[model samples]
Target: MYGLMSILVHSIMYTKFITPLGIDASLNRFFEARAIDHVQVLAHEIDGRQERRQGLKEAAEYIKAQLERLKERAGSNFRIEIEENAVGGSFNMMFLGHGISFGYRNHTNILVRIVNSYF
Candidate 1:
């Protein structure tokens, strides 16, 4: 995903026909520098194990913080909503011999709304 984003940024920077609104050269540089930081934070903070529930919560918070930073930087009324739902009875091979047949976990759904008409 990070690679894809990097490719996309490069394409945008080089393409003559495509003009991203509110994204200048400086903002593009900012995103280029911070993109790896965002990925690193998510990878370290979000442990996708069923046993560690706090990791999911922390992941949601981290996403929120990143979105908030984006809103602040763009000076736009971008909105983010997170909806968490419980997923029950998920089967895992790791639990095969532990006598635990099923696992329950929470999944977070993130929605970002960019109010700009160009989007």
Candidate 2:
């Protein structure tokens, strides 16, 4: 048989989403986590890898910590902007001739923008 590790991350994504590219490098630079230093600092690495309660919390904490670390390493070379919003709502719909109702409370959305001043 083969062996398995506790490493939670399986993938990484990088892109400049809606940013004006005017941030510092210290605020965006990370030591792996995604750059490959063996740290799992992404939401997708949630324990159990589920979008449910505890797992979600784990993922959120990981992301928060990573961002905090980046902030601590601040410099004028690059910049990073972070925003968090809590959204809750309910919806009712009919599916396959059945009535279904769903409501979510304290759903949080985190957005981060890494800007490179040079470009």
- Candidate with top TM-score is 2
| TM-score quality measure for candidate 1 | 0.47
Candidate 2 per-residue lDDT, tens place, 1-119, comes to 12223232222234345533333334344432345422443434555643346776666666777777776676786788878787778899999999999888666777888887778
List the candidates' TM-scores in order: 0.47, 0.48
Which lDDT tens digits does candidate 1 get at residues 1-119? 99999999999998888443433446524544366667887786577724556777788778877777666776444443434454545764545466555655566556776675446
What would the TM-score be for candidate 2 when compared with the true structure? 0.48
Which runs of model 2 end up more than 4 angstroms from their true locations? 1-52, 91-99
> Which RMSD does model 2 reach against the true structure?
13.4
**Per-model lDDT:** 0.64, 0.61
